[model samples]
Target: MKNKGVVFTTQAAMIAAIYVVLTVVFAPFSFGSVQVRIAEALTILPAFTPAAIPGLFVGCLIGNILGGAMLPDIIFGTLATLIGAVFTYILRNQNKFLAPLPPIVANTVIIPYVLRFAYGEAIPIPLLMLSIGIGEVISCGVLGMILYFTLNKYKHRLFAL
Candidate 1:
């Protein structure tokens, strides 16, 4: 039991660190209106292990702080990620194929408001939605699917029992 707990803790921390690092590395595309937010793809891991929820939320908080957005970015930005992660965690068990889409959808649905307000783009709502949603589809939907397959293949070895 001790070993299992240690493994879980280590795994969660590693995931959070990876998420923060990825967001930092992709800081340019990750912030402001036209965000790709590739790190969000990792949210699907929560389906396999619940640790991913906090792991991702904490990761986003760290990313927001370091990425250098002022108040709104730290507050609403992290809030958006937190909400998206929660939505994903809730629907994680419904279907393996469908699990990744929730976070993508959640972020897509929520991020446009942030973009419109934070960046003040003259872009229309549909355009903003399309841009953010498409980005998420590529990042969370497409990349997340790939991660799902990779992790699923290694579930026995990498994940907790």
Candidate 2:
């Protein structure tokens, strides 16, 4: 039991660290309204482990702070990741194809407002939604699905307690 807790903590910390690294390394495309946020690929992890819920939330929070995001972006962006991760975990037993949908939808819906109000972007909300939605599709849909497939092959070994 103690070992399980340790493993969970370790896994969450590792996920958070990797997310931060990916976001920072890809900073050019990890912020702003027109962003891909390659780190979002990790969002698919929730389909494999519940630890990803908190991991993603903390990672997004730290990532936003490190990326110099405004207050609203930090709070709301982190909440978006948390919401996506929880939903992904809840749907983990369903079709594998559905795993990334939550993050894609959450980010698409929430990030447009963040860009408009937080960053004071001049673009209209609908256009911002289109752009952010595109980025989320690329990040959480395309990349996340790819990751999901790859990790599915080693789930027991990588995620086992």
Q: What TM-score fits each model? A: 0.89, 0.97
How big is the positional error of residue 15 in model 2, measured in Å on the Cα after superposition? 0.2
**For candidate 1, lDDT tens digit of each residue in 68-156?**
87666677767777777777778876877777777776777767777677767688878888888888888888888899898988877
Quick one: RMSD of model 1? Answer: 1.8
- For model 2, residues 122-155, the per-residue Cα lDDT tens digits are 9999998899889998999999999999998999
* Residue 146 lDDT (model 1): 92
Flag clash pairs in model 1.
none
| Angstrom error at residue 81, model 2 | 0.6
Model 2 RMSD in Å is 1.1
Candidate 1 residue 62 Cα shift, in angstroms, is 0.8
Number of the top candidate by lDDT?
2
